[model samples]
Target: METQAAETVERVQPHLAESLPVPVRVGKGVRRLALRVALVVEAAGGGVAAHIADLVRELRVRGGVEIHLVIPVGVRFDGVIIGDDVLAQCDTVHRLPMLRAVGRADTIAFARLFRCLHKISPDIVHSHSSKAGALARLCFGPWKQVYTPHAVYTLNPYLSRGQRRFYGLVEGVLGRFRSDRIIAVSVDEAEHLQRVLRIPAARIETIFNGVKKQPLLTAAEARSALGLPHDAVVIGFVGRLDFQKGVDRLVRVAQNILDRGLGNVIFAVMGPGDFTVASGVSADATPNNVRVLGALSQARTYFSAFDIFSLPSRYEGFPYVLLEAMAANVPIVSTRVSGAAELITAEHVGVVVPNEDDVTIFADTIAVLAQEPLTRERMSRNCERAIESFSATTMIERTVNLYNRLLKEHR
Candidate 1:
């Protein structure tokens, strides 16, 4: 792996902005220098992993950018898996211990990460998610730093006043001095950064994460593979079975539907992480109508089987799963979380419940979709057209452009 990675690094060309529509500016003329980028991430799963993978793949194709990955050692939580192809594209790979919570172990991880960054000495250090974002900022070096908070912790409505203040202070301090640029995946998230965290408007950039439009299994085929009955209406969910994702709320919504005896609907939940533990609803007690299908590779392939795709997240920075649902032409029934409202219109794409945790409203929204097949079909048609704007090409181009602008200023 080491030799292969070195060979990959050796093949990097010296045409950083050659493929980009606009070239990087250095003084008066265009400067063509190979930009070395080191990506630091701790929550290397779900949307975070998917974003990094897409970004790395696009950067590799564009050429002239030496990419390095700094990730934690061990498997990801929530059955989240990063493809091997993402790692193969990198010039070097560094694995160190990184805990989700701030702990004594972080001191050791910090030292190791500092050494790794010192060795790479990348032109830009791009950190994904909160943990990596916080760590990369504190270990200040000559490299310019860009932090993508996937979703800020302080956005959690359930957070206590004291907890909100504490996390806000940390984010403010980091955003003010440590980070060169803060990338928010949604405009709603950018507003939260300015309003809640009090980060300067100049420091934040809104970049909607994009997804590739891929062929997926047909409804019949997808249902057959998943052992779901074609006769039943499936309200499918794809995400980590955790508090942030509101997996427990999803379970409750499913129960509410069952209790009300609304249609022949069954909820199909798929993702990594223990459903019983995360949802606080034991496996034995799980309703027969709710099928916990653990996790699957390329889960989006089965989105066709879903009559309605549900996102019950309490907070999010533009979820990639919603993008996948849109790509699949699956009508969404999402809670009005950070990016949910932006992605989903109340009746155009799918219903967006105003309340995040209200089980009745959520269940009612799902029931409405199930009962009105024409509404679902119309929304599905809308999804086909709406998804085109959120293309992978546009996203990749914008990111590279951001890198170019940041590097030009650094020079």
Candidate 2:
């Protein structure tokens, strides 16, 4: 991997802007023919990857820009992934070693990565999520950097107020001093970043995340794939079974629904994470009423099996799962978080219950949706309509336009 990565990196001619590590500025009679963009991430398989995947596809098609994709593999950090299909869009791929956001090892590893990036000298450096966002800013902030904390850790509901405040302090210091631009995935998230990070409002740009528009699976087809009976009222959920996702809360709600003999409702939770005990059985151990399927590789297609989609996340940025549910035309029931998912209520495509520990409200909401076929149909259609605003094409166009505007300002 080292030898191959070295060869790939060697292919690029460092065409740095007058700003040194920043992209070259077109001055006088010079016409800038191409811009160099580097997208760095520590995300493996999740919404971050989905966002990067869609953005990379759109970027390559737009042309006039050379993209160098850096993904840190062979380590535990959640970062970018470059599958063969995703590689087709990138001009170069760098697979370096990455450590999770702790310990001195992270400093050592990313220091090496910083040198590699220095060699490439990207004009535009965009970092995704928490770890990469911080590392990239430290490495390239003096040049040109865009940091997108797909979801800020400080805003996670699982964290105590003090812990959240500490994280907010760290992020606040970094955002104000390091980032050239901060891309907020949702409007609510943008406001929170400004409030917590004290980042200038001008530095933040809210580009609600987007998903690919694919033909959705039929209810019968999705049910067949999941081996569900025709009478089952399926409530589908896709996300990590982590503290952030609040799968424990979801399990308790499922148990309550089952105990009440609420129609033939089946809870299908899909995604990977550490397990926790709920009622009697472990959520990862597979409870009776809840079918906890480990992470599905093609989850993007499985959203259609549900009568309603649910997310009980403790906190979130803009979740791609929400976008997938909309594209699949499934109504949503989610806990209110500071992220863009709150738009569900504004758009009338889904129900948003206030964040609380009790499962009674979530169970009752699910029961209500199960009983009202007309309401479900109306919300589902609204979800389909909502997909247009968050399409892949729209996100790409906005992002590229941002790139152009940023270039002009720096130039």
Candidate 3:
């Protein structure tokens, strides 16, 4: 097995070597010419998948590039297809069966990718997420690589400090070989990458994620569907029930609200994650006036049920839920993490507080917002106004412009 693996590496080495030289720009209108680009990701899910889909759609509309999505093997995206509508706009969709394992999978994927890069000879390769970014950069040889971490790997609470440092070190080293630029979804994230990973500021660019405006459902309809009394003051949270989401904080805040005997106030947590006891919430445990809806796939439906949306995440790389909530004209109350602080203009859009702060403060803020209908309405209007800049069209244009500038400089 060792010998076979060695032989495979040897066979792929030449291909990697031959592909080291960058492709020459041939045409006078290279920018206008549809350049072949590969967008690689390890596993497609949630916000990352949404971003990829949006990027592909915009790239198609722009008409200057052909996108080929190269994803990991055995990664199934049921009911999601890059259909003829997308395919008709650009080039071919090539699916690579590259496994993701520690050593064996890495070697095999690198070998496969080395050969694929040689064959496709793409003008650019853009990678998303940690695994894909690392693997794509390692196997890229001399490809002009653009990496967007989506959310930096080091931000994960699951990693030990040493592990986080190691990952950052790896990213820094790889930055020299593979990355021409790193796109951070928020300035906070870019700063984190620079500080933790030692990636230079010059290599990092901050681009806030954008969403399309959604129509707000009537308060009556929203309240009725949520089983909330028409006159009840609704305070809502939307996101996964994961630790990083700080759902426990939200639950504790809910408990406090209920304990205070706040009249006509309902606390709802929309979205899903494991609500096991270990996660600080019981799947079966009941808290008075607390509604926990696990794993909401259709977020818009739940967004309609919220009078105010709160995100108590410990950290984030510009959450999509925030954008969606704003689009829905729901006032927000979020922790001062990532772009949330910058996005929430005090008394204009919503309130921003420190992470893991007192549950009373959180509960109090919600209670205050609940009591002041005019204030809530003002924040709601401000959120709607601020969302104009975050529209999908705006984000796509900015992203494409960046791509164009990068390609132009390199070409």
By lDDT, the best candidate is 1
Q: How accurate is candidate 3 locally (lDDT)?
A: 0.71
Q: Please report, as a residue range, the 10-residue window in candidate 2 with the lowest summed lDDT.
A: 15-24
Sort by lDDT, top down from the best: 1, 2, 3
What are the models' TM-scores?
0.90, 0.88, 0.82
Local accuracy of candidate 2 as per-residue lDDT tens digits, 247-343:
7788888878888887489988787675553223553555476776666667777777898998888788888888888888889899987553456
TM-score winner: 1
Report the C-alpha lDDT of model 1 over 162-280, residue by residue, as the tens digit: 98888899999999999889999988899999988889999999988898887899999999999999999999999988998999899899888988877499999999889998888
Q: At residue 123, what lDDT does model 2 achieve?
A: 81
Judging by TM-score, tell me the better candidate of 1 and 2: 1
What's each prediction's clash count?
Answer: 3, 8, 2
lDDT of 3 by residue, 1-411 (tens): 653342222112243333222234658633434567878777565567667766877776665565667665454331143333433333445455554444666776667666666666777788888878887887645457888887787766668878877887888887755688888998889988888778888888788888765555577876676677776777777666677888778877777777888857777776545655414866556566777665554456557677788888887788877888888888998887788877886326888877764667777888888788899889888986888878778887877767777779887
Q: Residue 40 error for model 1, in Å?
A: 0.6
Better of 1 and 3 by lDDT: 1
Better of 2 and 3 by lDDT: 2
Candidate 3 TM-score to native: 0.82
